[model samples]
Target: MISQSAGKIFLAEERGHNELNWFRSFNTFNFGSFYNEHKHPFESLYILNEDTLAGNRKISMLAENDSCIVLIPVVGAISFKDSAGNSGLLQAGQAQVLNVYAGTTLEISNPYEEESVNFLQIWIKTPDLQSTVPQLFEFDLDKNPNQLLELFSPQKKTLVKTVPQPHGVIGKFSGRSEAVYNPAQSGNALFAYVIEGNVEVQYRLMNPRDGLGLWDLEEMELEALSENAIVLILEIPVLKTV
Candidate 1:
């Protein structure tokens, strides 16, 4: 068990947005060329990048070590092939998790020639920084609307197969309603990202693609302010050393 206190909020507009010829990315925490020492990883919760790619455009693959990366498609689809000879397609209703140890390279591309695809890529740091063999897991998002659905739970091996766990809980909230979040791990922090429509966290309004990070609280209230609003919430440790 960890110490719990009042939670703080990190606004979305304060983040960095970078637009390029092939990709447009928004960084919730310092990433790529948008570096901010203060806005670095939130405890073990490292990176959250919202990206949009032009159809048929390929973003050069990623080479990382000892990191758990999750990709969720929002608007379209993406085709990916990893150095480990794993390949798959991620659509709007699906999500993918990549566990990289030691080191691995991954290539992602938009398959459709006329439609653009938008996705979110999140990185969570593990306790042990040592590298391991790369593995990929893709799962379909729960279709439950107007409620919170657990997408990934670190202790639940049946959810996804990987090491280190990250010791976090990731969920998807759909429809317009109020939901209470109780961290599976006491003293953990919460990071909520609005996928579509509007949502309010602790009385603070968040629009599409907006994000808020809360910590030190036993529970937090989340309200979907508009129809079809979708929010992704991640509960991670508040201590940086975790």
Candidate 2:
């Protein structure tokens, strides 16, 4: 059984870090060689990695079957090409969702000449795919400051038939601004990550790169402690199996 505590905070410094010649990754959960018995998968959300790729360098990974991968560029744009014949450049203001099959090689590269690129890679266990195409969503958090901007939601009719879909949103808020988030479904878990600046979630203070997981709650509260605070929220359903 999962913990029924009010919440669990994963501190930024506690994340597992991996450094390579061309890549540096910080894993929020067990991934690659970064495994922690306490840092287990949060419900259906399996992987949350903050990765930095060196300029002109690339890395490839095999996609997992029956899963969804989400990419969000943080510091710079990233160019990606997959064996499935899908390719694109994902900018900072956009999010990409890919419905991948097993054995598909996905290569992500930094397009800049001398600057490194930072991005987030999230993996969620999903239902079998009905379509293999990728989807891109563009959002301007600066234009709609202090409000949550939806990035990807499985509830969309256009989404491939992946049941029990996770909902993702990003928001930029001003200092002292407060917001309330209601889960789309009861029993769903909420994972909040502070992308920049300070914030308080459910009364727990969080710094940049910190993550908080809350479950068995109908609503969660957030308050930005600094100007231009950016946050990412994921409402994930708890699956029967890991």
Candidate 3:
């Protein structure tokens, strides 16, 4: 078994508001610019943006080969429009995955006459999608199994059809997550960022306004000891090199 750290602990901080008038809410720090150069190809397992859109306002469809995308809502509910002309509403505890194959436009809107919606957008690297179609899996609070949430996955097709096992799951632990990584999970890397509460990771404790760096490792764990402790964990598959 490959033994190593679970990686480090860090916190997710709010950046600012987005430029879109229709897309309201706090634009998170991880919301990277299109112009910004990326260091590791899929290393940037996530590009986040907490969005709050106005009624009837529409967001442009966005996609990048650089990553697989997932959306999580903190408050309010949002609907999406895809190239397949598919549309649906995603509520709190609801996770949406974006498959940007050959690029598709995604229009996000909140049309409820009473409430405004807030959500978080997360991007990760896509696994090999050869001869497979894009996928989506949803978990609702009423039926959600654990304290965690599985919002999206691009590898679901390959995992379900071939291995009978799924790659990894990104869960939001309100206070603290049982930071547990499996050894059987071969060819993967771990990333965790605190969005709400503080977490003690190994000997390193992290609070708001901090970020932990990671690379090839074995296993990592996280613990949040207080109320409202929110953490976003990204399990990115390490790309095999030649």
Give the winner by TM-score: 2
lDDT of each: 0.69, 0.86, 0.54
lDDT of 1 by residue, 1-242 (tens): 53434544456777778998878988888877888766877776777888899989977546554566677788889988767676788887666666665366777899999788998888776645433433444444455666666655543432333223443333345555788877666656788778778888767788987777776767767888787777778876555452
Instruction: For candidate 2, give the lDDT of residue 162.
Output: 36
lDDT of 2: 0.86
Q: After best superposition, candidate 2 residue 88: deviation in angstroms?
A: 0.4
Displacement of the residue 147 alpha carbon in candidate 3, Å: 4.9
Q: Order the numbered candidates by lDDT, best leading.
A: 2, 1, 3
Between candidates 1 and 2, the one scoring higher on lDDT is 2
TM-score of every candidate relative to the true structure: 0.80, 0.91, 0.71
List ranges where model 1 is wrong by over 4 Å. Answer: 1-5, 61-65, 129-143, 155-176, 238-242
Deviation in angstroms for 168 in model 3? 5.1
User: Ten-residue segment with the worst summed lDDT in candidate 1?
Assistant: 155-164
Candidate 3: C-alpha lDDT:
0.54
Write the residue-wise lDDT of candidate 3 on 35-117 in tens digits: 22332233545455566767666676466553355766668788877775656787776676655554656777776865667
- Candidate 2 lowest-lDDT run of ten: 155-164
Clashes within 3 Å, all models in order: 4, 0, 12
Question: Which of the two candidates, 1 or 3, achieves a greater lDDT against the reference?
Answer: 1
Runs in model 3 deviating more than 4 A are 1-17, 20-46, 130-136, 140-157, 160-178, 208-213, 240-242
On TM-score, the stronger of 1 and 2 is 2
